[model samples]
Target: MSDPVDRPGASGVPEAVATPRSRWRIQIIWLVPLIAVLIGGWLAAKAIVERGPTVTISFETGEGLEAGKTKIKFKNVDIGVVKSVALSSDHRRVIATAELTREASPLLVDDTRFWMVRPRISGGTVSGIGTLLTGSFIGMDVGNSTKPRHDYTGLEIPPVFASGVPGREFILKGADMGSLDVGSPIYYRRLQVGQITSYQLDPDGKGVTMHVFVNSPYDKYVRADSRFWQASGVDVSLDATGVKVNTESLVAILIGGLAFETPDDAADDAEAAAKTQFVLFHDRAEAMRRHDRIVDTYALVFKESVRGLAVGAPVDFLGIVVGEVVAINTRYDPVAKQFSIPVEIHLFPERFTSRYTKGDQGAGGRLTADRQKLAQTLVDHGLRAQLRTGNLLTGQLYVAVDFFPNAPKGKLDWSANPPELPTAPGGLQSLQESVTSLLAKLNQIPFGGIGKGAQKTLTDADSLLRQLRTDVVPQARDTLAAAQTALNSANGALQPDSALSQSTSDAMTELARTASAFRSLADYLERHPEALIRGKQEDKK
Candidate 1:
């Protein structure tokens, strides 16, 4: 080799031996793999530190979810993203794998609820429609508990109180669930304040119980004696004040809803506790009937039929409603064996009576004593309960309490479970009885005999008139003609140029001539011997 350091030895060129320079001789290809491994390891460590709990959710459908795209949200804020979606083992549902951010780690808990938010229509209301443009996503509803967890079953139905919708929940029980459903609006007065969350038939099968939510400020209006009514559709009433129309709102008219009002002595400022049960009425009028909460029960035994009178008929005191009929039953006396209607009514004196009284006793005692005293006074002054016609067209009946001084006397019975009040006949019943009596008297009249006698008398009068017209009229006409001829003769005799009028004038002239001769004789005699005194006055002429 010519020079070892400068050798082209493989091709037979000269090799040169010179000082060998040491080099940093690691392969860059191997370095690339090493640097990639270090970088990947660091990334893996960072990912491990940052990764939140992985949750797998089973859904009925994978309708709106896409791997690496779909995100979980709470109150419109993003918290996690879907990593993968696959069919469940049984192929019945979709199992979604989601990677939650570390910040959302605490959301997984026992009561934490999850559900897919999508456009849905319920109770004539459109909701979640905003998701149509934004694409569907998972919704996480935070729970009430503080316990940290990592697994949860998603809700099929949306929650009523979403994230921060401030409100309290209550249950309403009614005889029937009429046009009410989930998401039905709850109204205070006529405003849309809250919604009906859920409902179910009462376990005892007595009624339907609905779970409702009353939102923030409006919830404070509900009180212990607040009246809730189904303010749905149109309510038209024809009463003494003519036709009346009542509706809560246009929304309530279209889709059914509930409305509430503080009626009696319940507080308005203090809120009723959550889950407090209330009775739901069919309409506002029905709810108002129970405004006076306290009831003083009384019984009235009516001898007449209690037909057309329902249990809810208004019990009025001098045209003002003071109570409602609770029940109507028949009782038979052992001795008389007569069945009489015993009407039980709840008399709410609180409607017209105040809690404070003359004495310093507690309200309860004062109310009791006042009621007793008033009852005794009423009984003494001939107070009685009677039925009256409320609607003449429908013949609907109502209970009326009034003083009847002319009523047959009866004593009150306070020892009974429901204190017994004296009763008079219903106004309608009395009217019917009077009409029946009149009909009976009418039936007793000899109508056929009267008609025959009237016909005979009419015929006799007709015959008499005919006789007068034919014979008597002619004879009277002849007599009147004779009298008229006599009157004409008398008129002719009194005429200015008639023979009788000439005779009378001649007689008057002869009398005047005789008088003149007598005057001449008297004048001669007076000249001689004051002849026969009175005759001398004619001499001056």
Candidate 2:
């Protein structure tokens, strides 16, 4: 006992106090952490349950889209948020991961479209302008189908009209699209009621095919035979009507537009079908006049040189254009064995048949009958084809159709399909005839014989002049000189004391005495009343 005390060195006042072992018991304080963990797990499960499916949208660019910030909207109502944005493997597009709410799950269909919304200009209008201030968001369009989808491709441009817009579509075929761009207005009598949805090149590449949308009410006015024209900007045309400035409105003059008008005589009962293609005229006049006139073709054989005549030359009737020369081809007349130039002219009637009877084929038949009757009447009226001068400055010739009273009496051969018109002497023919007549008159003169005679006459005249100058002149001079000498001698003989002067004085005295005696005898005879036939009565004085 002493050794154990020394080893332990126990210096206790009381022996070991016996204590009971404490039993393991549940503590309410530990349950606080467990309860908290359970509540957290439940909250996590509820959050996951409400969150909808995640979709991946591929876009060409992620300009304004940001992960964890951008929201997806429908009609401006946010329904989803972007989760992630990363470049695709090929780097051609940006892969956008978005989480859509459960309520929008049904909207994600095969035809659903998704696109990042930013301020953009489309169809000449501004849209998504609100995105400029607040921020950009994703836009979604619901599809008609019910099939759900997780992937979508974006639209480059917004649709012309949303799914709710009500309108009908039509197709217009034109030579060219002109200035009618996308969103160009469609005018009905200067009032805009529609717009151009799209345009593309025709399948055959010959023209442009425009996709047009005409709103209701206005579209009802379109008839089967209505005219459609491109009202693009301003149309300035010059014709007999003078300067025509045509524009539907100021807006049309800017961006361009489409216009339609039904002719007054057009059938109002027949309506144009949807997508029924119509020719889009560049001008309103052409559209209105397209089907109004009837065209007739005729061939004329001409013998004159058609050098100045060309295709597309006008065929005028009384200074009015009635036709155009389509072709000038050579033809051989077997019976005459002569090659002649045959001119084919396409004639549109000067006046259209105004009144058309009811029924489809009726109008056409009546038109043909009227044309045939008119042709017969014209032929009887001496309608003749001739080549005449059109432009004097250009020396261009055109075919002239006229009623000639002096045309070599001929008849039109209407038995042919394209009625053969009668021909007359063209301007060139008359000119040639005049030239030939002039040449014949010139050739009739015997120029050589006349020249010889003239030559001989001139020689004789020269000889006569020489004879007068030499022989006749010298002889006359000699005769004149001899006469003068003789006269001078006679003058000298007749002087005062010459013998001729004395003889003259004696003769004059005797004659005077004889006269006195005669007078006295006559007086005696008068006194004796009948002094009969006495030769002389002498009186002594």
Candidate 3:
């Protein structure tokens, strides 16, 4: 180097000196590599920290989802990325491996649900327009429940939107689902409180079961004594008057819904224990009671067809819906050579007992005077089967209950004689039989003889009318002509130039002059026409 420049070193002696240009060159070479190393390390650490757990989400279809484009979002914010997608072994589902970031790990709860957000159209809502632009993605609902969880199976079909309500699960067995729809509101004591969640046929496919989710607060009001009914849909009816019913509100009338009602004797303790996840129908105690009731129902058997009996058809103590038809079955009566359909009716005496009775038994199991009154009502107005028409055209018949004043007032004597004829014949079958009998009676009438008699009567009437027109009318006309001829001759004789006319005129003039003298005579004659015959009553004048 030239003259060892005075660049200071650690040893203060002029060691192998470097120029400013060379030093700058050395810094550029060494610092560039170090900074590159630092940048690489930083990138590696970021990648490791951001990397998340790999979860395989199974879906029935991947029509709108993409591997790299689709993201896993929690609450509308992206928290994971889908790395790859492949079909499962069964090929029924698309298994997508998604990476959930470490930051989002805490949000993964046991009850968290994952569903793919796709465009859907339902009753009134059309959602997922954003997916059209950025592509559809899997949505994750991370919950805080402590329950255990497993791999999520994303629904191909969107889950029905149901409000998470605190209620007990009730299984309404043998319910009709075609009679129910979503948003079909549920009623509690006639007050709308919730809606039906869903309805599906039981796995065994014997009956339909309705899944009704009652919203919080109101859900607690349901009790074991609660009864459900199909509250919506058009119920057309016709009687002696023509067709009549309330058929407005087209949607409400068409889409039937379920309603819940509780009896007055519902247990409060049972009502309070009802929580978010409580199951009402599965309780052993409640099940036992239902079983006992079923057993009680089977004890009695009727000996006739209760065809066309409906689900809510009443079993009246008097004239009320104290109970309903639970079921109907047909069994062959070998002696009668006919099928006898027995209707299983359910009764809740607690509902009507209070309304009609009074007095109480003091601390004893025995009933009081009120019980006697109730017994009398049961004896006089106990359940009676009456004929009812179901459909006019179909001629279906049903058994109904009514308290007719003429009905016998005593306990039903099962051993006594049955009615000789079907009770009163009020149903369609009875009407048909009556119409047939009337037609038969009409057929027996001698229509040919009546027709011949009617023809003879008409012929006689025609002959009488012709005789009146030919003989009587002609004779009357001849008499009128003779009178006209006599009047015409008299008019001709009174002509001005005739001799009779001159003599008549002179006589008329003389009569006019003597009219004053004849006035008294005329008045006297008018007063007494017979006086002229008796000679003028001059003495009386």
Candidate 4:
């Protein structure tokens, strides 16, 4: 705190001193703009760094899309926004340009999927309802591919299921698509477990192929021996057991669906790999049929009408289904001048044979020679095939193979391409024959001659009754009058009065004396007769 002392110098009058000011000093007012500029620069750099890539999506139509309004979302989270919407050069499609967040950049790969989401109803499902209020948006499904892409195709229809869902895909080949469509339910034991993703007609135009997805953990149930069938509507069947109604679910009955089941006795329960191919049977019954490698094909020639029998009818051994009728044809026996129905059947011997193996086969998947011999032996023992009524109400018939001990002896006609198995008349046919024979016997009766003879007998009886009324009746009347007269005379004579009464009294007195004398004589005779033999014994008193 000391004050500076100035000493008197050479110029005492020049005491004033000059102090220098730095030119580099900034004004306080300028700092405000300078700080503002620095912050603005940093924000610009951040915007550049966070900016994502722009991509174009081609769609069939831009029905609900708008530039700068529609958003691209992944799992309901906004990931991008549409920057522009325009038509393609050919005017056949629409192209939408969108900007996605930087974080989503990695997901835009070769297989990434994009689609417009809006309220939609398909395959018995109602979805995207939220879009009805919030407006439509683009849905994105990330791909696993590493290759990046800038241009992509947008799906017109929303996927039945999203990517990353735990499941396995499968392909079903069938004669027809039936009632199936995208998003159609796939059922397991009547429970919905997945959906059909897509379908296409085969290149050769012979059949259809469908792709389906079964979600976890149900997917694990699909096995190599699994059978898939169309369970779209109410399946009604009439058989010997009576009418049966089956349906997978109410949904399936309305919108069509498919079902799969692995047989309990399936030789293989190994899980089927993804995209494994399977046959799509028309119905559960066909799907459930055993696929036996060793089959014995035979032809059964039936002499009677086969009106109720149909192809695909079950061939039964006892109560078990051992085969099915494959083909039915009519053949003419020129030598015998007769027409017969030849039914071709495929019999799976394994169905009836214990522990039969598929390897035990002869040429053309037929029964082995030893097995054929065994079949011949069975035929020798009266094994026969007969037509049987399966459903009386429906008049449906099926083939029944059984051992009829009384069946006539016959041999297998091996000369025929498909060996002919001996056949016996069906019970119905036998009944018809009996009825026909009885009718024939009834027709042979001499009913006309019997009617004439009865008429003659009736006429004769009528004549006899007329004669009795004319002659016998008058004679009987006269006889009755005479009898009445005789009765009157008897009444007068029997009266208890006059001389007859007096005479009767006297006669009675005389008869009593005579009776007493006779009695005495009888006693004497009795005693004398006894005495004659040995005199009467008197009692000693």
Which of the predicted structures, 2 or 3, would earn the higher TM-score when compared with the native? 2
Q: Output candidate 4 Cα RMSD.
A: 11.0
Q: After superposition, how far is residue 516 of candidate 2 from its true place, in Å?
A: 45
When superposed on Cα atoms, how far off is each prediction in RMSD? 9.9, 13.1, 14.4, 11.0
Best by lDDT: 4
Give the candidate order by descending TM-score. 1, 4, 2, 3
lDDT of 4: 0.90
TM-score of each: 0.63, 0.58, 0.52, 0.62
Judge candidate 3 against the unseen true structure and give its global Cα lDDT, from 0 to 1: 0.62
Q: Point out the higher-scoring one by lDDT: 1 or 4.
A: 4
On TM-score, the candidate that comes out on top is 1
Per residue, candidate 1 scores C-alpha lDDT tens digits across 23-140 of 9677667988899999999999999999888888888889888999888997789989999999989999888899898988777776788888889887767778988888889998
lDDT of 3 at 335: 94
Supply the TM-score for candidate 4.
0.62
Put down candidate 4 lDDT per residue, 1-541, tens digits, no spaces: 4333444554456666887988998999999999999999999999999999899999998888999999999999999999999999999999999999999999899999999999998888888899888999999998778999989999888888888899999999999987788999999988899999988999999999999999999999999999999998998989999999999999888899999999999998899999999999999988997788678899999999899899989998879898899999999999999999999999887666554566643332343436777789889998999999999899999999999998889998777889999999999889999999999998999989999999999999999999999999999999999999999877766678756766888999999999999998789877677765766668799
Assess candidate 1 and give its TM-score to the true structure: 0.63
What ranking emerges by lDDT with the best candidate at the front?
4, 1, 2, 3
Q: List the residue pairs that clash in candidate 2.
A: none
- Tens digits of per-residue lDDT for model 3, 5-94: 444664476567665655435655688889999999999999887776777788878776678878988768888888888999999889
Candidate 2: lDDT over CA atoms? 0.82
